[model samples]
Target: MTVLDVTVPFSTQIREASQAQHTEAENSTFMSDLLSGRLGVSAFRRYTEQLWFVYRALEGVTDTLAGDPVAAPFLRPELFRTSALERDLDHLHEGADWRSALRPLPATETYAARVLEVANGWPGGYVAHHYTRYLGDLSGGQVIRGIAEKTWGFAHKGDGVRFYVFDGIANPAAFKREYRALLDAVPVDGPERLRIVDECRRAFALNTALFADLAEATR
Candidate 1:
């Protein structure tokens, strides 16, 4: 089986759990409900700001990793484009009074930081395997899309979930092929392959734990 076949189940589980959490929050949080009510304007603005911060941070990290050949190709900086999305985030950050009005709650930031720490533990090989092999293909984007639609799209507008739209690229098959080629290019034996897969699994688990923590924190 391909690497994606092995990894997809975990991704699906994570997405399901994430969707469920959002559903629960819709019922519980007035701010969330309010944000959803605003849809394309305020809710979109807030999410875009947060995404800009995250993408900027990740871009820096990716650049640092790119110095190493083994890790460089795995660092997909192209995936985090902000130009189209930046204007909205900037508008919200500077113009919107509600930017500070809505805090993410302690759990939101805590869970996010934890996930980053967990990803940091992954080996360069595993990152390459996951990013170049599985994630670069539209699978990762699809996951984000699902989250966006379920969490923001139904309730809000296009602006709130701009992060989820991958520049209107609908065909993921070509990307998947390129991703698999990258994986095949990696020179590793059985044990090393297993190690990479293990790290990938850990990455997913860390993500899962993070969402769970966020849910608990909000509760």
Candidate 2:
């Protein structure tokens, strides 16, 4: 009898495929300065403004994707940060109507549009981008939140960084584990898996572009 070797999980493949883009994003001039407390609050606010565009686009489809078997399981109320983003915006841009506070950069517009594109079709592509953004936030985003608080002297769990505060997740570690399991279980053939992996990289590339654009503008 011949033995067949089990292949690596899709989650692992995604992580590997997107690793370069992920590193570029983290090491991008904007993220590096912001995370290191070298960037001013105005720049951070600008970053948040861009985030509003991208996340709003992503969450806008949550209701639509919520019924999807592959995407539904990943959608959690706690993971939703648009409300927190609103509060952070209110605090960050007090007195101004945050609604018209800032315009999306060119890269930000592209990123937001890509998210909307996948939301209506290509569940794999949708999942790929969703997993890329939210998971990235839940992971390294904590560091950025901390830097924001310490640099700007915002209260812990306070308005400025509230977007990073996940009130719904009691244990983020466990939630992450469960999320990865869900990633491992996404039903896809080899070609579809490759496509999703490609989308993940594309998502990260879009993010890096946003960062690069921000860095250029802020400088």
Candidate 3:
């Protein structure tokens, strides 16, 4: 049983531990093409469609864990993205019913299922998934938003790109600092901390897998 050294801040531990996975996810083929403007609007729309399923599953467990000691500290309602995703889908679908024809790729199904599984049973694990997602959105996700807006000629932070726009967060950098503080203070033991770090890596791999699926399907 390897115990994580508590002398290091938990936030830094997880960040360092998951750095490789994070880099792999960022360098995924689909994302590289999308960000480089090689992929078309349909590709971006399809990617956003997949995000709706994943966010729905993630947010679905929020209410259940709202009062949980381990999960409650990370539950910021403003971080929720289902509504924003829906609006983006509305625009992507040109006002059609996205849900009626919605389907998750196999990887997305597995990813969303894992999110629900951990969220239902382990608050620490749930936070692992949460941190992997929202933090990345605040950070590298801005690049995607910028590329999408420029490539597709969408209005700035409107309609199609709303998912990357965090209207409630006035300062993303400060909010990320506060979020890392919450991770640093997550009230869990050494083994649990290690487990959470592993989960964060897994979350990134799952995300990368989803992108791989998109690449294959679009190819």
Residue range 6-45, candidate 1, lDDT tens digits: 4444334323433443344334443343334533334444
Worst 10 residues of 2 by lDDT: 1-10
Q: What is the lDDT of residue 211 in candidate 3?
A: 99
Candidate 3 has its poorest 10 consecutive residues by lDDT at 1-10
lDDT of 2: 0.86
> Every model's Cα RMSD, please?
7.5, 3.3, 1.0
TM-score, predicted candidate 1 vs. hidden true structure: 0.53
What 10-residue stretch in candidate 1 is worst by lDDT?
A: 128-137
Which tens-of-lDDT digit does each residue in 1-219 have in candidate 3? 546777988999999999999999999999999999999999999999999999999899888998899999888988999999999999999999878998999999999999999998999988999999999999999999999888899999999999999999999999999999999999888888989999999999999999999999888
Residue 3 shift from truth in candidate 2, angstroms: 20
Q: Please list the C-alpha lDDT of all candidates, in the order they appear.
A: 0.45, 0.86, 0.93
Best by TM-score: 3
What candidate 3 gets wrong by more than 4 Å, as runs, is 1-3
TM-score of 3: 0.98
lDDT of 3 at 103: 93
